[model samples]
Each structure stands twice: as structure tokens, then as C-alpha cells.
Target: MSAQDDVDDVGEFAALLRALKERTDRSYGSLARRLAMNTSTLHRYCAGEAVPVDFAPVERFAALCGATPEERLELHRRWLLAVAARRRPRTASAPEDEPDTAADPPPLPRRPWYRRRRVAVGLAAACALLATLASLSVLPDGRRPAADRAPTAGPLASGTTEAKAPDRSSPSPTPSDSPATEQPSASATPKKKPSPAPSARTTAPPRSGRKPAAVPLTWSANSQAWKLGCGHDYVIAKPPRQVPPPPAPQDAGTWAATQGAVHGGETLVELSVQGRSDTAVVLNALRVRVVGRTAPAPGNAYAMDQGCGGAVTPRSFDVNLDKDRPIAHAVAGSDTGVPIPAVRMPYRVSAEDPEVLLVTARTVTCDCLWYLELDWSSQGRRGTVRIDDAGHPFRTSGIKGLPQYTYDTLARQWTPDS
Candidate 1:
């Protein structure tokens, strides 16, 4: 009946609830809804901040916890005691017949006092009977109550007692007794989970086979310096490179171990030339633009082979450079928030060499220091050839090269090399 005595019970129930959630892989909110209890109420109970008011609420909770009926009833008994202790007076229990200040105020004298006399007698009889039953012994050995025993009947009744069935026509004894059954049909229809206002974070799972609507990309074609291409020529008919499995990041040291570039710049070019790589080929195009800024390079764009092999195949001369597509631009590099211990600097250029931008990005320390560098070169008669140190090559063979800046580490400054 006291908190100390109820501690074990409370802990047991909490553990059971946790086990249920784990078994079903349901969140507390979801389980609370299934239990027909307010989320906060269930949370409070689980936290031991407050005890459940009735066994029914706990019954559902136990069900969710996957507790057996026997376990549930035992838990219910303790739950009742804890709640009762909380509501109990600070002092010792009062005498059974003592006037309780917490009792409901008497009804207003709407009718004459004489007319209410029989009603008062009936109430007194009920109270007296309840008190007598309370005095009856609870057997140490559990057994069903005598079939003919009428608990509400006092000694005044004859030895032969008969139990009467509850009148079905009568309204339910308590709202808590019939919550699920009394719930409105509307409540039965799965309620659309309340969504957060636009700014609120979403925590719900996405529908099967569908993803959450993506946040609209803020960067658009108007912002892009070159047109992004579509159709067969632009289409990647075959994947050039296979994505390697990401190494397990067991610790900072493990993460740092994977810090180095997986492949060298030349290897990337080879992958692009052969179309044996996937994402690297697109990066190669950017490198071409970077390198082309300084000198004339052949305008011929190379298409990679179906497989990312050393073999290079030529595609029809596509006149247009596609730059309309959105690209994630990075500016700075550091490891401030990265789990790894290094920095990652990213740089981007529009479809041409002229529209270059720098991105500072964090590279989580893994097993490598993964550094990205950008450079350029010129092939006489061809045109400006820019190379992205991120291991991408771009060939602005026919297009006019844009002015670009090159970092001169010795000067500790950016120089107008283009």
C-alpha cells in the first residue's frame, strides 16, 4: 500500500512494458494509443511519476507488454495500492465510519426533506453492508467466493444468501469499465497520425515503397551556369563502377584508417575514360572544366565503355554542355562535427570553367585522410582543360573557357592563373 512496498511492483510493470515494446518494435506513443490511454498518462506511469488509476489501463499496458494474465493481475494489484497510497491521507487510515472531508458534498435540498427519507435509509443500508463485508476474512488460501454468498448482504440476511445478476439495462457502472466498447466509431477508424507543422520534425515511418516528399531543392536551373542534359546521349545506359562496401567504422582509429583516397587521380581518369566508374565520370567532366580554364584542350568529350575498363570509346559530338542540374556545393573543410579526424574540402564549377565555387566540407575521420584536389592543363589545338583534384577530369574542348583562380600555396594566396 505504501510506495516502498509497491516499488518492486512498479519496476516489474515498467520492465514488462519495455519488453513488450521491444518485442513488437513499437514506440511508446504507438503502444499508448493501442492501450487506449493518453500517451502522457502511460509515460508517467512508466516513469513511476504517477500510478495508474485503474487496472483496465494497466491491463492493456500488460497486454502490450505481452504479460500473462496471472502476471497482469498481480501487477494490477500493486498498481492499485500505489495509486491508493498516493491518494491516501498523510496520516493513518481513518475509522471506517469517520466522516471523510474528501467525500462529495451532499445534494442540494431540491425536494422536501421528508420525501428523501427512504432514499437516505437505502444509502445507509448499502454503506452498512459494505462495512460488514470489509470485516470478513480474506482467506490465506485462495478460493472462489461461496456461490450463494451475497457480499453486500449483512448478518441481518438469513444464512441462505442468493447473488443477483446485474441489470443489463442499467448504464455501465463506470466510464473506465467500458472505454474501448464505448469509444466512438470515429475513434475506431485509424486516426491519421497528427503531422507536425511544416517546421516540425517528422518522426513517422514513410509508407511502404514510397519515400517522404523530399524537401524542395533550393538551388535551381536558373542558378546553374550550364544546361543539364537529358535523353539517350546523356543517359547512362550502363553503370561504370561498382560501389564498394563502406568499411565498418569501429572507432576513430578505424575511421581514420580509411582516410586515404580509394583510387588515385589517374585511376579515376582511367575509370572515366572506360566508363567503368559511376559517379567519378561525372566528376571527371568537372575536372575537365577546371583544367581547361588555363589552356586550350581538345573539345572532344569522351564517353566511357559499358564497363569501367581501360578501353575508351568515342561517342557522337554532343554540342551542348548540360549544367542545369542541381549540384551540392561545398565551401569549407574541417572535422568539427565529423566522427572521423580529418577535413574534407569540396569545390564545384558550373558546366564551364568560368563559374567555379569552393565548398568547405567536413570529412569524418575514418581510415583515411581523404583529400580532394583540383588542377588544370591545356592541350594545344584542343582548348582549356580543367581537372578537378577530386579525381574528376573535364574537357571544355569546344566551349570557351571561363576565367578561374588557382591556389598558389607558395604565395599563400589565390592567383588569377586562368
Candidate 2:
């Protein structure tokens, strides 16, 4: 058979196998054993990777699947048509003296409906005669009419073209070449439903010091815009505070006082303890990336490590920069006599309750005058400061361009709150 014929058969076979598998809960192994075939062979058949041209295996598969008898017969009919579609007859002319050597006889012309009825009637009459002769035990009967006995003649004899035969006592079985009348039986097995397939993605892991499971942050691409929704809003200080080192001890060893200012705006920041913090970070990092797009001019990514040594349980905390924070001192100047305009840092954080926080309103100064003016509320919380340089506002808030800094005890990373 041709290659095209092979593909059609395999396609039909695959359909049959899938249907069977759907109807029966049995796996490939079970079906293979039932068919008395090798598992790999059956697998290839179902996969459409086996023989290219035969429908025999396909019909076998349907039969083993308990497909209805009519379906089986119809399959055979289709197979014949497929074969005929691919068959190409040789067209070379034969030698003049040689007897005709055609592989198949010329197709008979179709008869008109009335003519077909007459021809069928004549055939029935001939069958009657043949049956009668066979029943009589006429032993190699040459006694039959020469018309019926002619070597080249069929059911309609040569000389009897104008006449039809009389009915005989014996009845002949219908020709095997004629179509059958039996309807196929219904399938005996009860129908079954298919099961759902397993998922491919993995689930999130648990975190420390937390009650509920951590919610991992998710991100998706649409067209151009990105939207961020976090557990808490971020703060964007008015004029971002200039980062500075801690002040030196003056009198004896009195610890320096902690002082800082906050902002109220569209941006916000998140600050949390370590061990339990990783969970929230992972869960909401993606949201931060989405909403924190108002980047500083000439933006650059940077990291800061403010060790909260021995003070907090865990040693360090780090920030996940969607892009990066601006260098506060360089951009917003030192927080000495005047509080430079703080850079707006937009961010999102995940927590028990989520809120948006903004940092820095107008200009906030560091204290030598011992007081600076500031508004810190967009962070879902509120705070105010009127300190005029208590010798240094910059000293407390800006270790790394951040308005405030915190130390993570669990993970050793520094986090800045702007």
C-alpha cells in the first residue's frame, strides 16, 4: 500500500485505541496482554509510530475493544476505500498478439434502476436453477441447459438474454458477495469516565515564626503596563534624607539618641524582623516590582548592610530593589542646616494587614538646631518631627540613602525604610 494509505490507517488506529482506553480503565499493559501483543508494540500502535499502511491491526484493536460488529464492518469498508484511493493501475499497452493481461477486469457499467431490478430478477432465476441441479445429485451434471453451462457465462446465461428462468424447488443461500443484513450488537461493558491529569507547577515552602503559610508573590505579563499590589504601602520622603554615619560619643559613653523623619506620598517601604520575614518578602516581592516604577533620575542598583549586631535576635536584613535606590547624599544633599528633598521610593510589602505608606513631604533637616520639620504617614501609619539639627538628623536616618534603617536578626541583610 502507498504511504498516504498507511497514515490514514494509523490515524484510524490511534482513534480506536484512545476510544478503548477511555471506555476501559485498564492501562496499556492490561490492554496489550488482552490483545496477546507486546506492550511496546501496542504502545507504538496507539502512538501512531508503527507500521505505515495496514488497517488490519486497527480493526483488531477495535474488535478487542469490543466495538460493535457494525462498526467493525464499517471499518473494513473504509479500509477498502482507503486502499482503492491509493491504488494506481499500470497503463502500458499490451503486445498485439498476447492475450489481455490486465491485473483486474474492466469495471462493469452501472445499470439504470429498472435495468438493475431486471438483472437481479434474472440472477435469482439462475440461482434457482443451479440450486435445483445441486440438490438432484445429477453428478457432474452436463444435463443442465448449455446456456447455463457455458464456460464464460455467469448468473445471466449467454443465449437466454431475452428470457428469464422458471422457479425451482430448492432455494440457494444468498451470495457471500452481497452485503449482510445483521445489525451489530450493543457493547456489553458499562461506560467509564476519564480521570483528571496531574498539575505541573510546584507549591510554595513554609517560613519561620509565622502562623499561616507564606503567600509567594506572583507576576504576569499583559501588554506594556504592570500593576503592583503588596501587603503594605511604601513611603517616599519629601526630599530623600542624606545618609550619614552615627555621631561620636561626647561626654562619657551615653548611647546616641535615635532620631529620624518620614514622608507622606504615593510611595512606601516595608520593615520587618528576619526569620519570619523571608516568607512575606518572597510573597510580595513581585508586587513591589510592579508598582515601584517611578525610578530616580539616572537610577542605579545598590545594596547596603547595616549590621544590627547583638541588638536583634537575627543579625541582618536586606532589601529587594525592583530597580535601585538613589544615593541620598549625592541627590538630596546632606541633612545639616536644611533637609534636601527626599527621593520618592515606591515599594510594596506583604503582612497580616496591607497598607500604602509615603515618606517625605517638602524638605526635612538634620539637627544642630535640634529640630527638623517632617510628615510621615503614607505608610499606613503617621509620625511627625520638628527637630533643628540635634547636631545631626542625617546621622540617624541616612546610612544608605534611606530615611530609616533596620537590622534583620535572622537573615544577615540590611533593609532601609524610605
Candidate 3:
């Protein structure tokens, strides 16, 4: 497979899983039986053909392999990394599907980028929306086709009921074209409903036996968009046609606060954190980027260690720049924050909730200010968010140039309210 396919197919996590399986000294068939999964599926997982969206299979595989606590932890870590890499754009390098012959000359060399151009946003509005248009399939005559029309919902006592009208687009059939038909017999056997699959999140069954209603189709959490209404009885409502939403602003919810003069190239924002009262709030990429005056700093503004110590660095805090994972979700945690990692220094981040960064005033002792030339991206759009100084506090809430930004203490990230 090509490098393109390799990134999606043979990512680091999947590679580790395959190695573990080999070391376990079990055949794919044996592993499948133990895990209660299909042999082909086990093969896929080992081959790195696909990653199971469900982590249950992975955990089971690791357990079967007799993984130790440390090994198991590593597996989980790689799994997360693999999951994240899968989520990210994978056009890092060109694909090399076909190998060149020995007789062929070598390919030309490629140069690395110094200052990079902006990366395009991922699928902006890829939402799952259903558009159920009435699929009318009737005869040209004012009557609907018996065989062609789906079994109608809500059955009556005995005699047949009138079917929905046919498509208006079809030419109407005259009396001469109409076929003689008899009413549906009450004795007609009702087709048996295939049992719902083990993993299905079935919608409520057709209105109890008395009156059969259109089976309200719903997609399972584990299912794809195309696998709609699987394993159901006579599907009353066909799978809904998906309607893609209109394009959203490519750079929605991504900004950086800069300080230096806007000469050319990318924009820059100012950063100033003085005493406890006037210290400017530090925000995540989606919120703002603080730039320095004379010299640049790794994280904070000019001076460095504010109430937070010098040992404390931006990396210490959990950094969440993925636009889709908003700061709001992180704030849902308690204000006290996940306290387990605070002792480690600048911050403590829970593996379960990487977005949640926990830092306390106790950890940061120095009373100082910082200036930073920030760099970060949110959602898909990436750029330095430019905001002019209009005597307004270049704080968490900047002037008009930047959108409404909110800093979440619990999650330790910036959220673009507007």
C-alpha cells in the first residue's frame, strides 16, 4: 500500500497491535473465538486494514495477549495517539504506490518548507441530516401499484386499503390501462421480522401489532451513515437521503493575539501579565496568542514566571487546540480541576480528560509578567489572530478584530463565544 494508505491503514497503534498478536503465539482464528469476533475482522485489526471505532476489541486483544500493566498502558497510549492521528489530515507526504524499476532513474529531491502556507480546514459542516422525501410509486391510473408499493403502515381489520398516490411526474394511465385487482386477503402471512443484531441501537418497533406504523428509522451509534435500518423487518421508511449542509467559514473559531507591529506576513498580538490585578489571562489557540515586545518567550509574555514558576511551561498544561473539542465541554468539570497532576509542577493532566488542564495558584509562586509569540490552530483554520490596540485591555476579551473569546478555567482553554 502507498504511504497515504499506510498512515490510515498502518498507523503506529495498529502496528503495535499486530506485533502483540504475533508475540501472543495464537492464530487469528483462536483469537477471534476468544474475543467473540469474526476471523476476518481479527485479521483486519492485525493487518491494520482498519481501526475498530470501538475500543472493546482492542482491550480484549490486549488482555488475551497477557499484556502487563505497563504494556497495557502503552497500548492505551498508542491507541489514543493512533486515534488522534487518524482524526488529523494525513496528506503529510505523497504516496508511493508503485516502485520504480532498477533500470529507472531516481526521483527528484524535495525541499522542506520554512514559513508554511495556511492549511485548509477539514470537512467543515459534515453533519448527519436526514431528508425523507415521499417516494411515491403509483400507476398512471389514480391507483397505487400493489406489488411495487411498500406495505402501508397501520393495517385495518380485513379488506385492503388505498395506497399512496403515484409520482406526479409519471403520465396518468387511462381506464384502458388500469389492471383489475382484488382486495388484500386477511389470511396473507405476515413476514417474520429478522431479530435485531447484537450491536444494533434499534428504534422503537412498528406501533404494536394492532396498528403497524412506519418503522421510525434511526442509525446506531456504532453504525455508519450507509448502514441505516439494518436487520429490521419490512423496512417501512427507506433509509433517509443525507443532505450536506452549506459551507461554514473556513477559519471559524481560530484566532491568535499578537503584540508586535503588523509589518507584513502573519498577524501578531501583544501579551502583558503584570501584578495579580493586571496580569493578562493566557488563552488557548482558539482564543488568543500573546506576543512580546523586544524578545520572545517560550510560553508567557516578556518577563516570564508570573505567579506561576519558571519550571512551569505551556507544555505542562494540557493543550487542546482541536476546534471540535470546545472548551465548554472541559468547563463542565469541577472548578477545583483534576487535582492529581498539580504536584508534578506547572500542571497535572488526566489521561482520561487530556483537554482538562489543572493548575493552582500554589504551584505558581513568582509574581512576574510574560510576553509570547504564540502559535496554534483550532478546528482546521490556522493563523495569527490580529487585533489592534484601541486602549482596550489586550486581555482575555480583546478588541473588535478578534471574536468574543472566553477562557475556561476548568478545561484551561479558550473558547470563541461568537
Off by over 4 Å in 3: 1-9, 88-418
Worst 10 residues of 3 by lDDT: 222-231
- Residue 10 lDDT, candidate 3, scale 0-100: 40
Residue 158's lDDT within candidate 1 is 7
Per-residue error (Å), model 1, residue 166 = 25
- How well does each candidate superpose onto the true structure, as a TM-score? 0.22, 0.19, 0.26
Q: Rank by TM-score, descending?
A: 3, 1, 2
> What is the C-alpha lDDT profile of model 1 across 293-331, one tens digit per residue?
121221111121111111111111121222322122322
Q: Tens-digit lDDT track for model 2 on 1-418?
A: 3445546754674565676667777888787666545565567556755331233345556766777867666554444343332222122333578443222212222222111110010111111111111111111111223223211100000000000111235343223311121211111011111111100111111123223222122111101000111011112222223322321111000111111111111111111111112233221111111111221211111122232111111111111232243211212322113333332322332322222111111112210001112222222332221111111111111112334443343554334544
Ranking by lDDT: 3, 2, 1
What are the lDDT figures for the candidates, one per model? 0.25, 0.25, 0.26
Name the top TM-score candidate: 3
lDDT of 1 at 102: 30
TM-score of 1: 0.22
Error of model 1, residue 142, in angstroms: 49
Candidate 2 error regions (>4 Å): 1-6, 52-60, 78-418
Error of 1 at 85 (Å): 2.9
